[model samples]
Target chain A: MYYRSQYPRDLFAELDRLQREMQEAFDFSPSIRGLARGSFPAINVGGTPSSVDIYAFAPGLDPASIDVQLEKGTLTVAGERKAAEVPEKSTVHINERFGGAFRRVITLPDDVDSESIDAKYRDGLLHIAIQRKQEAQPRRIAIK
Target chain B: MNMNESTQVAKAAEAARNEAAMLPPVDVIEDTGGITLYADLPGVPKDKLSLQVEAGTLTIEGEVALDVPQGMEATHAEVSLPRYRRVFTLSKELDTQKVNAEFNQGLLKLRIPKAEHAKPRRIEVKLT
Candidate 1:
């Protein structure tokens, strides 16, 4: 006879909680939608069998001030962008630059190698390289 | 051609030149320590972005265009538009090594770290 057991209800509840948190964390909606006052950061995620690549478009922000964290298959990016310097005696008619505190989070399914992750910034773009988990790569075995 | 006709031609050429000179707007702010600059440059790629600092001013230039392909007509474009160009003056306390910048979405973030001498520090106290 074969014995089978189902997952505990607490474990299922925990999984549900995590899913809710993930949904809240990765919301891509802007605070002021359809308004020209702010520019929402664009993001791209690409992956191969052995690696995953994430790109964030953020300019004029101090790299040191920005923070990136990954936990429980979730990626969180947060930072504060200072306002651009303006001359004392200049009057401006139109202002369309975005400045303030901003935060973005994403949930990833791929097993990312946090230790091997690499981040690079150039021309105002942040590129993150995440090595895929070894088990996530497909393989074949010969039968004896 | 008459002198008036030649003058009109020159005026027309000058107007064309002005129309073609469409540079993005920029703002530079100077504080007691350093300067901060903000530039509006949409659709600028990392390879095309360049910054040059000569004399006392820093110049940032990037080329961006709405690529509608060879035979395609522009129906609508609301994502990104044109290019951005801006410049700024650098101060002495602005540490170039610590100067950090990032660009997300379409916003450019630049931080000119203050010099060691300019940054605030706290003295530790020892009790006997």
Candidate 2:
């Protein structure tokens, strides 16, 4: 059953890539500007024996402005990025940076303890650590 | 062929390699004073960043650091750790000597002032 469901998911992903490529081919502006439709605030999630760590890449954001929350085995990072203000009498040649409110939700493993979670933002990256529950930890068994 | 042509070709090849790694998004704004460039380069620290200008060409490079936890494997991975690099050609009217740079939260800001001759000036009226 698992192998059967995997085929269609891979096919759907391939089709989505094709559609995006076709859109880029038709739209000459993005190609000329060399811009790709990349997602905002890219993230990496990994875990250790006792805890799970999530790293979010978000530049040009104030650390104090970001809000992190965990509930129901889901972690959410929300924040706003302000647009750069152009000076008076200055003409803008090219404007490409996007600024606005953004929120990213990540579903964590059920073994994580809801009470032992810590989050910190530093050097344009947000790091979140969630401890695993005591019951979920590995134990050594002795041979008789 | 001269040395300049060979160097140009080498630069182009380096740019191609950079694009394959990661292309950092940028915004260029021109004002009366000069041009301001803003680039989004997350996960890159100040020490790992590089900025260079030569023969009216500006280049930026940054290395991203990824710290995975010890003894843990990633079951689901989406983000790829790639270095950031980009280049831009500048006009002769801009003064490279007066350029300024600042990095905060992995965002790079470059300010290039316009040359004196390129700036606007008002001539005083004289009676004959």
Candidate 3:
């Protein structure tokens, strides 16, 4: 495993590139670590029969600054987490929080209805729900 | 090399790797009077966060509640850990009894003041 540097930002970028290549090679899915590497804010994608749900773990950010875009069956969440305020003349022992701009893209299933989407931000978690196509939903036909 | 020992070693390494993913990043700042600590705890609400100071030790624990929406099951998930845990030993010079904490926008801020006795003092001298 080769890493560019100890800084989390660069390290994550390296992992992201690696993961993208792997994804193309083997159709890999993001995990907790390894391919995912806890990039900036972690993301989770799930779905129900009627709608697709996406939960993005983005903390310490203003909801107004976040940009959400849905285009061509792809959803993108982009935002910047401002650096926390630190008092002057203080000794900083440990600083591990990643600060700066970040963006995440999630590709939804083809059945997802692009017209209907709902998003909310609460407790640092951004949740997006997109309705599925009516024709794609599972159906039980009455016995004739 | 014992085979069982090697297996145990691999398991320990894997556990460490997994734990690192869950460890919340924290910043500890120390000034003359005391120390201020900040932690990023996303998706954790006030009811789910627990901060405890016991026997000269401070522990921060936050649990992320993933409320699966009604009739929805996760199809793909990247974040798996539900809890964040971190522990630290406080300096004896600091007053543990008076610790202030506030959580807003998923960030936890804690301030621990220095003990009264630990403050700097100067003595006065008179000419004889």
Candidate 4:
């Protein structure tokens, strides 16, 4: 079974590499722009019968700087991560964190109630909850 | 490849990928006082963070906890829930004893002070 899985895994990796090479060949700019696509803050969206929840993984952000906007059924979270101040006359060894303006958009289900949306930031994570419309919720039918 | 060999190879590849993925991005700044390191570890609470210095090496580990409501199904997920880990070698010129760390909103800030000998000194001229 393990041997069988390896073949497909290798094939997938080969295809992925080829796709990346083709992208590079067609585009002169770097594939990952600062805080773009793969580099943007990641998010998770889940829903229950009552409400929809969104968890955004954004560390090193000032909660006050974060901006949340809802339009139609789309929710956008925008913020800027400021760069740390490096003292003068000091040599920098490594820097991997990307800092700049970032905007993440999530489309909520049509059943969500925009007026009942709430968001909070804590411990470097942003939580957004939107209540589901009462009519859209699942209901149990009664037998006569 | 045999089943056993293939399993071993797959395990090795998985381990390598996890190591790469868990490496949290960091920014190291050096000043006259010492060097400061900043690491971005999202979703890690203060209590779940660990920092230690042993044998001139500094290690930072943060566990990210995701709270999912019960009976809820995830429809879309782009973020991964992986613990953050990173290590740095401290030079002898740094005063490890005076090292201090502060965490706020998922950012870890470490301040390592410079030893007396590492600081710049001025020599006073004596009248002949």
TM-score of chain B of each: 0.55, 0.76, 0.73, 0.74
User: What lDDT is obtained when candidate 3 is compared to the true structure?
Assistant: 0.78
Give the per-residue lDDT digits (tens) of candidate 2, residues B11-63: 99777554534567677888888999998878888998989998999989888
Residue-by-residue lDDT tens digits, candidate 2, A1-144: 111211122355547755765675676544342322244566678888899998888888888889898988788888888877788888778766667887877788899999998887766878888999999999998999
User: What are the candidates' C-alpha RMSDs?
Assistant: 17.9, 9.0, 8.0, 9.0
Could you give the DockQ of candidate 2?
A: 0.44
Poorly placed runs, candidate 3 (over 4 Å): A1-34, B1-21, B120-128
Top-scoring candidate (TM-score): 2
lDDT of 1 at B82: 40
TM-score of 4: 0.75
Residue A37 in model 2: lDDT:
27
lDDT of 2: 0.76
**For each candidate, what is the lDDT?**
0.55, 0.76, 0.78, 0.77
**Interface RMSD in Å per candidate, to 1 decimal?**
15.8, 6.7, 4.6, 6.1
**Judged by DockQ relative to the true structure, which candidate is superior, 1 or 4?**
4
How many clashes does each candidate structure show, in the order listed? 19, 0, 1, 0
> Candidate 2: misplaced stretches above 4 Å?
A1-37, B1-19, B75-78, B122-128
Model 3, span A1-144: residue lDDT tens: 222221233345557856665674467554423444457677888878898989888877788999999999789999898776677877889887768898878778899989999988887888888999999988999999
* Candidate 2: residue B82 Cα off by (Å): 2.7
Q: What TM-score should be assigned to candidate 3?
A: 0.76
- In model 4, the runs with Cα more than 4 Å from the true position are A1-37, B1-21, B121-128
The TM-score ranking, best first, is 2, 3, 4, 1
Please report the candidate that would top lDDT against the real structure: 3
Fnat of each prediction? 0.10, 0.67, 0.70, 0.80
